[model samples]
Target chain A: MTATQLSPGRVRKTPAGAAAPGRRRAFDRYLNPVLGAVGVAVVLASWQICASTGVVDPKFSSSPSGAFGALVDSFKSGDVWSPLGSTLSIVAWGMVISIVAAIPLGLLIGRNRVLYALTDPLISIMYSVPYVVFLPMLIFWFGIGADARVVIVVWSALFPLLINVIAGARNLEQSHLQVSRVFCASRLMTLRSVAFPATLPYILAGVRQAVGRALIGAIVAELFMGSAGLGYVVQLKTSNFQTDDAMAAIAVIAVIAVLLNHGVAYLEQRLTFWSRTD
Target chain B: MNDPRRKLVVDDLRIGHWSRRSGTFALACDGLTFDVAENAFVAIVGPSGCGKTTFLTALAGLIPVESGRLELNGEQISGPSRDRSLVFQQASLFPWRNVVANIEFGLKAQGRLDAEGRARVAELVELVGLSGKEDKYPRELSGGMSQRVNLARALATDPDLLLLDEPFSALDAQTRELMQEELTRVWQADSAGSGKTAVFVTHDVPEAVFLADRVIVLSSGPAHLVEVVEVNLPRPRGPEVKRSPEFQEISDYILSLVMSQNKPGRRTEDHDSNAALSR
Candidate 1:
C-alpha cells in the first residue's frame, strides 16, 4: 500500500499552479520576522510609556531602556559569556547522556514484551512526577553544584527521548520484521539495519522535546542552587531589585531555547527527509 | 552435497492450533500429501479460510506440524531459513531503507558478499526495472515499485524455494496483471542458470492457471488437497496465453471445485451418490 493508504483520513491536495517568483519570495520574507518585530515593538513601547508616566514603578517593572542598559553592561563586563557557556555546556552534557541511555533502552523495551511490562508502570510514575520535586533530593545527593544541575536536566529530558524512541521501535511494521526473519539477519544486523533506521524519526522527535525540557531543568536548577549561570544571575538580580538585569537574563534564555529547539528540528528534518515525503 | 534435483515432499501432514477452551487440536489435516518437483511452479488456489496459508506456513516451518512429516531436499523441514523465502501479500519493504539497500539486505544477512554486493544490487535493481530509484526509499515508491523491490530482495539471495502468498492481491487489476507478467518473465530469465522451485498462493483461479505447472485446489477450513490439475502451457507465457482455451478449461474446472466446496451439504450429496452407485 502507498503512504496515503497507510495513513488514512488526511486529504492531500496538490497546488493548482505555480505563482510568480517575486510574489512567492515576498510572501516568504514577510511571514515571521515582520510579525515578531511588531510584537516586540508594541511590548517595549508600552513598557517605556508606562514606566516614564509613573503608571508602573520603574523599580519593580523596569523600562525597555533599563533592560537594554543592563544587557549592554552584562556584555561589556564579560560575565555574560561564562554563564551562557555554563548553561549550554550543561544542556549539551544532559542531551548526550539522554541519547546514550534512552535509544538502546527504548529499543530493548520495545522489542521485548516482558521487559516493557516490567518497566511500563515505573516509567509512567516517574514521568508523571514533576522534575522540580526532585531538585531538593538531587541537591542533597549531589550537593549544590553542576552535578545537581546536570542530574535535574537529565531527569527532565530523559522521558520524552525514551518515550518517543520506544514508540518508534514499537510501531515498526510486522511485514518488515518478517522480511528480516526471512533473510536470517543476525540480531545485530536487524537492530542496526532495520530497527535503528526505522526508529530514527521518533528518536529525533524525542530529542526535540528533550531540548526544551533540558533547558527548563537547567535554568530552574541553577536558579534554586547555582552560583554562576544565567539562571543564577537572574535570581541574584531579582533579589537585589535589579528587575532590568533579570529581564535581560530571561530574554537571553528565551533566545537560547528557541535556537536549541530549531537546531534539533533542523537535524530531525535532514535525517528523516524520507518521512516527510511519504 | 550440492544436489540441484532435490524436491519438497509432504506425507500425511497434519497441522492444527490448540483449541482455546479444550486445549486440543482445533483443525486437523489428515492424509494430505504432495510432492513439488525441483524447478516446478506449484500454485495453491482455494476459498478464504481454507487453511491454505496455514499449509504454506507449515511447509515453510513457520508453524509446527501436529503429526506426520514434511521434507525439503529429502531432509526434515525445520524453522524458517534462508533457503526458502516468502513474499507477503503486502510488499513489506523496510520503509526506512532505499530500494538498493533493501535488496542488499539478504546478502548482507548471509555475510555473502563484499564490495561486489553493490554491483549485484545494481544488477537486481536494473533487472526489476527500477534502475533510477536506487536511492529512493520504500515510502517514496509506488505500490508496484515497492512490490518490485520486495521481489528483488527475495531473489537477491538466490533462494532455492520461493513462496509467494497472494503477493499481487493488493494491486489494481491492471497492475496485478502487469506484475504477473513481470514475475513470469523474471522467473523464466532467472531459471535459465540456476533452477528454482516456487509455490504461489492465490484466491484467483486464472492466476493459478497462468502461473503454476500444477494447481492444488484446497478444501475449506482444516484444508486438505481436493484436486491437483496440471497445466501444459508453454514457458515465457504472455498475456495472450491467458485467453487460450486450455487455460479457460483448467480455470473453469478449478472454479467448479472451489464453488462446490463453498456450498454446504454438496460434498455429502456427491459422496453419498458415489457410494450408492458403487453399492
Candidate 2:
C-alpha cells in the first residue's frame, strides 16, 4: 500500500467536528451550577464582611457566623424540629387541597366558553384582593388553630395554580385537538391524552410561583395569630432580643423556599423533555 | 382493515360556516355530489379559497353538514371514526411522544396496542424509513421526517379511507418531491395487503396529476365540483415521468381548468365591450 493511503491526514473531519467548539460552549452543562455557586458565595461573603466590620449593626442584622451558631444551638436543644415538622405538614396539606379544588374547576372553565365567561370576572376580582389581608377575619371565624392556618395557606396559593392551568387548557392548540378527533377519540380520551400533557408545563410554572405564596402564607398565619411553627419561633426569638436565633430561622425559611422552587423546576424539565428552551 | 372495499358517497352535500366577523353563515361547498370507488387515489385541486379543505374536513366528520347524505361503505358518517383517518397539512405529531409512541397513538386509542400491535408500529417505522429514529421526538425530526411519522400514525389504525389535506404543502420544494415519492411507496406497500384508499386535497396542479388516479377540480366560489379528469399514467412513475409529454399535457390541462375557474365573468366581457363602444 502507498504511504498516502495509510496517512491519518487523508481522512477529512466531519462538519460536526469543525462546529464542536461553539456547540460545546452553547451547552456546557457545568456552566450553570458553577456560576450559581460563585454568585451565592459572593453574596454570603459581602454579608459576612458588612456584619463583621459593623457596617451594619451585628446585633440587629446578625453576622453569618452568629446565625450559623444559633442554628446549631437550636438543633441541639430540639426546639427547631417540632416547629419545622408542623410548618411542613401544614403547607403540604394546604397545597394538596388547593390542587384538588383548583384543577377541576380550572379545566371546566377553560374548556367551556360559557362557563369561562361566567367565572372569569369573579376570578379576576378574587385574585386582585390581597388574600393576606383576610388573616384577621379568618382567625375570628375559625379560631387560631390548624383550620385557620390551613385556610390562609390554601387561599394564598390557589390563584396562581388556577390561573396558570386555565391558561394552559385554553391555549391548547386546535390542531392537536383535531388530531384526536381524526382518530375518533372520545371526550375523556382527548382530555387524558392531549389536554393533560399540554397543561402540565403551565401547571408546573404555577406550582413554582405557588411555593413562594405558600411559604409566605404559613409564615404570616403562624407569626401573627398562631402559637406554634417556625414563624412563631422566629417571632418569639426576635421580640425576646435573641436576634441571632431569629436570623437563623429566617435563613432556614429562605433555604426551604429555594429548595421547593428548584424541585418543581427540575420536575418541569423532566416532564417537558421534548420542548426546546433554546 | 375492516373491509378494504369500502367506498365513499357524498350526495347533495352542503357545507356552511358561521363567519363571526361578518355575522353571516357563508356556504363553502354547495351541492357537492361525488363517489369515490374503493382503493382509488383521488386528488381535489382548486384555488386557495375553493374550500377543498372544507370538503375534506366534512368527510372526516369534523364539521356538521348543512344538507346532504354522506356514506362510507354504505354506512352513514355522523362523527369522526377510525374508519377514516386524516393526514393534516402540518404533521401534528404529539410533541410529548417519541416517534414509536406517536405511531402507537392510534393503536392505543383503539385499545389494540398489544405486543403484536407494537410490532406493527415497528414495521411502520421501518416502512417509512424511520427505523433508527423510533425513539426520537417530533422536535428532533425534519419536516419530511415528521410528515413520514404522521403518515405512519394515520396508517397504524389500518383505516379504510385516508384523508390528506395538503400534507406536503409545508415542505420545501426538494423535500416535498422526495416526500411525494416516499408517500407513493408507503401507500402502495402491500406488505399488510390492506389496499388503503385515499382522498388528497391540494392547490398544486402537478402534485395532483402526479400522485392521483383521478384529479377533481373545483370552481373558485363555493367550490362547485368543476371536473373530474382521469390520470391514465402508468404505475411505478417517478420524478423522471414528470419530464414526459403525457405527464406535462395532463398537468397543463388541469392547470387550465383551474385558471378558467379562477377568472370570473370572463365570457361576458366581449358583450360588455361592444355595448360600451356603441355608446
Best by TM-score: 1
Task: Write down the C-alpha DockQ for each prediction.
Answer: 0.40, 0.32
- Residue-level lDDT for A30 in candidate 1: 77
Worst 10 residues of 2 chain B by lDDT: B270-279
Position B82, candidate 2: lDDT = 81
- What tens digits encode model 2's per-residue C-alpha lDDT throughout B214-245? 99998774767888899999877788878899
Runs in model 2 deviating more than 4 A are A1-57, B1-6, B264-279
Give lDDT tens digits, candidate 1, residues A66-159.
9889888889998689999999999999999999999999999988889989988888877788979888888889998887788889999999
lDDT of 1 at A177: 69
Model 1: number of clashes? 0
- For candidate 1, write residues B39-130 as lDDT tens digits: 99999987666667667766666667877768888777777787888776678887667888888889898897687776767777887789
